[model samples]
Target: MKNYIVASWILFIIGISLLTSCEKDPWKFDTDRKPGLYFVELADTNEISFDQLNDSTWTRKLFICYLIGVPVDYERQIEFAPIDSASNMKFGEEYKFSDAILKAGEVYCNVYLWAKRPAVEDEDGKRYCTFRIVENEHFVPYMYSTAFFQVRVNHPREPKWWDAEIFGAWSEKAFQVYMRYYNKQEVENTDNWQKYYSTVYGKNMYIMNDATWEGVPALFLPLLKEDVLVPVFDYFVANPSDGVDIPEWYYEWKKN
Candidate 1:
């Protein structure tokens, strides 16, 4: 009977141990913990416009952060392996990721991808690159973040009229018309012609050469439609002889 009681006690202890082992640990899949890998800007593909080629390269940023719960103090070395078959954009040819592998020891860190110029320009062709962040020893990548790792290159635009010598004479005439009306208004607020010129074109035209205006539009049409500036500009254009006559279009504009 003593032996039987001892066996029963042993079975009870075993059952308790099994129950304890089955309980979920606080650290695993904790509700409060939200550790993640992410991009700072959420887009499936980043766009590069070779047409607006003012700079040598275009850049985008990637970030990794702890959302709700911080993991144990640890550092991770991130890796990006380009999927060559899936992309026409070649690494070391068209693009590269900067600051890719490093110790991510803080709350958040940055990784950058740079796309270079003379990007394979095609009017209707698709040019792109897909890069993937592989699994590393320290952190598991969020699948959503990995899916959108892409860069798309667009075709450059051909040079237009604003890109030639015609722009200089046209800008001078437009500025002359603006000044003529300014003197007639008799409103002596000390705003200079350069400021007025900047307002008409949205940037300082004096500083920009014709080659820099390749994709830009002519200033006259936009200035001719402006409410305050156009009335004066229209008057001078219609009455270049310094007469007191207002055009029918000005009266019509004022009536409305």
Candidate 2:
């Protein structure tokens, strides 16, 4: 009888251990703690053709912020716009590439901005604005302009462990920890590495001509070699509109 009780207790303990080990981490899918998104528009006239107002030539920048709960804490973020389109041009207003190439008259383009939600706010909000094109006296649209695009913000995925590790690092010790465990398997190429790293690191590292790892032995290099950087090269080759290049170091590193 005593042996039976002992065996049952052992089984119970084993069951409990298995159950505890199998318990899903509550934080894994909890996006409730994510940051919020802030969107803004910036104008550029560098591409504008002075002679051809109707020509699609103006440039613009759209900024998206990923803040940590606090809206004010939002930092430098991604920018997106269209390419090679003609629309009305205003002397001082911002215009996206999509806005630049509308029909000579009035037209519309739906603009979107994506970001994370504040940790406390269950529901986020979206802001809508308009873009207008006014023709010059010649009845020919000479200037392309946009008041500002409607900035519809949406909550993106919360930062994963690796994201936090890479972007949160402020010291050598912290950086090394990021370099050691963050999975590089998903980062198939240099462009992928750049996008992933920038999303997590909060800055553009792949574009950095002189980026280097500090605080660790020189032998423990975390830099991607050129051959291994093929993915990034192929990405740029495929998507020239992205306006970024795969650095020469990546190609050099790949040859080895």
Candidate 3:
């Protein structure tokens, strides 16, 4: 009988705690809160991804929700400002946002974002921007914050197991061609190559020390053939970069 009373009390306490936690849970989307404004969007919700060669612009729909017991009698304009310093993609050139309007009797409104590709691909071709509300007459900025957008590039990186012997000494162009032939992309030796090659861009690249590459060569033997290098050499012959013109080693391979 005593155990039953004790068990009942324990259950009662557990139920009270759960009710309290639910009341305080920030993610609990309750409409009965004190009047406030908040964004119903995630940090990466506004991203624009594109292939530089194929795509130019992307349009996205976004939203803002708030708590109000009564319907707003008139339309209210919600304004936003670019977090300028955080924005990498330029305003007039790469992106544009139109002010959104909250119509009468509506709890939410739509926001539109348009993104344009950069004129020339920057090294990684990735850019970012953030936006936040500028308070207006109807309502002010809320607890939940800002909108973020990214123009992120998705280019393949050279595999960790990339050995210069297979690609015939790595050049930016040569690696680009090699990626087409090689199917595997393991993260095993990425750091080893960086240390072994000690590559400095357009400078003292590839300090060929046999000892540095001695132990791991057999384990990470890159797939290669003499003919596969033909396209690599051909790409450079057709289109050479201004600064790091084709290396002599590629030509040497062509002659032999």
Using lDDT, give the best candidate's number: 3
lDDT of the structure predicted as candidate 3: 0.56
lDDT of 3 by residue, 41-157 (tens): 656766565442222245444555563445568888877778888788777667777677878888877777777654446424367777777676666777765878776544444
For TM-score, candidate 1 versus 3, the one ahead is 1
lDDT of 2: 0.34
Q: Estimate each model's TM-score.
A: 0.45, 0.21, 0.41
Query: Alpha carbon lDDT of residue 26, candidate 2?
Result: 53
- Model 1 CA deviation exceeding 4 Å by range: 1-23, 30-46, 50-75, 101-105, 118-120, 123-125, 145-256
Q: Candidate 1 on 1-256: residue-level lDDT in tens?
A: 9999999999999999888866765556754433555544443545544333232356454444332236345565666677787767778777677765434346555676666554345423365666666666544556444423344444223333232232222343344444444443334432543444344443323333333433343444344245335565455556563323333545455567
Better of 1 and 3 by lDDT: 3
Ranking by TM-score, best first? 1, 3, 2
Q: After aligning candidate 3 to the native by TM-score, how far in Å is the CA of 13 from where it should be?
A: 35
> Worst lDDT window (10 residues) for model 2?
46-55
lDDT for residue 186 in candidate 2, whole number 0-100? 40
Which pairs of residues have clashing backbones in candidate 1? none
